[model samples]
Target: MPDCSRPNRINIDLGPYKQRWVAYCALHQLTPSAAFRQVVAKLTENMATAGDAAAAPPTTRKHRKEIGLTDAELRFVEACAEAEGFSPTRWIIALIQARMGNGAQFGQFELAALGKSNLILLTIARQLRQIAGMQQGLAGGPMPELLPVVAEVRTRIANHTAEVAQAIARNIERWHGK
Candidate 1:
């Protein structure tokens, strides 16, 4: 029992809802205090009637709330997803995860591109290593012929790396509409 003399010792009977509240908290992986904080923030937001929506900073979306979209909006989403070479559902999920800062947000096409780039880099690295080994195995010193080949391979690596970086930047900018 709480001490009634204490000013902050307010209580509310949960009755049958206590179990449900506990389940809700468990489902969301939040402690009671954390859940209550979200509830309080939402309550305050609802009570405030004069706040400008545009002036408010964007909040992290931490819950699943159903949003209604018109046909036009759905089409727009589909078009945007198609432009990025992704399905609408994948695009939406990727967007949400990106907003949450979960990790890299790469579309299917972007991923394939990166994968190809990685494979090329690996092949180039192997060739460079082989050339280095050959140069080292030589009796006297570095071979002039192998030197030009090594230089060319290094240039290829640098150019390919730059291209991959640019592609990643473009994809990120497209994804975030920046």
Candidate 2:
């Protein structure tokens, strides 16, 4: 019998769009794998961009304004950079990038929230698994010899869940207050 695990690569006949893809890949200096990865990255990076061209948000063609910052605001920006262990200028640029929708800040926030909730549930599930493993280990079985390690992982996961929940709650409260 043939191995069923590997994916089959088939040559798809692209009637007209084949040239376009080739040209795009050539222009971007990408190999086949790199081109595919780039296309996927771009689509994943901007979900809105994957929509109909006419329905996409209007692009801002004008140059961005360089507004003067107050000393207090500058200090706050610097403090935030310090706290995050990033350069103040790069942090400001990242903020601008996020505002311009060049980066996935909104998507990241949604994913982080979802991950935090899932992590909490995963922690409890892992704990249960560890308890099961411990029971098996107590029965003189070698399969569950790593019960102590699993328990430690469960403890770390539980702590992480609490921290994530607290942060999420604080964000929600602050958002509602605004």
Candidate 3:
């Protein structure tokens, strides 16, 4: 008889998609086993969220799974999650959900804020370019007319630069492992 303590291995036949699946795994730098596990995990997570009766059992903890982690890795996860005001399990779930889905690791608000920052920077650059063109096309010692625009751009760049840095730091802290 087979040992019950050991995990059972199963073979999957991908048929025509076998090459495509292998290529995807290679591109993502994941082994076939890891990719398969992720796909199954994501499917189960979705089913659980959808309240599929067959996918969930009464005796089982719906949201818990024992992912093998070394002692040091577990400690690191705990520490990182604690710093981010989440339990290690919650952190891991969030990471997996974000990384596995077609979404960015950043929260919606965080992504929006970053997008707004990029737009502001682009506008500032355009304003500066316009001012430079005006200066170059016409001979002028100083353009007092554009001083207000320059000042505004300088202020915005300074403010938005700081905000972008903070956002980047927060995102890196939240998704460091990913």
What is each predicted model's overall lDDT from 0 to 1? 0.78, 0.64, 0.77
C-alpha positional error of residue 103 in candidate 2 after TM-score superposition, expressed in Å: 5.1
User: How would the candidate models be sorted by TM-score, starting from the highest?
Assistant: 1, 3, 2
Query: How high is each candidate's TM-score?
Result: 0.54, 0.36, 0.42
Q: Highest TM-score: give the candidate number.
A: 1
Model 2, which residues run further than 4 Å from truth? 1-49, 52-65, 102-146, 160-178
Task: Tell me how far the alpha carbon of residue 139 in candidate 2 is from the true structure, in angstroms, after superposition.
Answer: 9.1
> RMSD to the native, candidate 1?
12.4
> Listing every candidate in turn, what is its Cα RMSD in Å to the true structure after a full C-alpha superposition?
12.4, 15.3, 14.6
Better of 2 and 3 by TM-score: 3
Kindly give the stretch of ten consecutive residues in candidate 3 with the minimal lDDT sum. 100-109
Supply the global lDDT for candidate 3.
0.77
| Candidate 1, lDDT over the whole model | 0.78
- Specify the poorest-scoring 10-residue window by lDDT in model 2: 102-111
lDDT of 2 by residue, 27-127 (tens): 88886667876666676666656666635677778566576889999898888666544577756765666555564222234446667768767776777
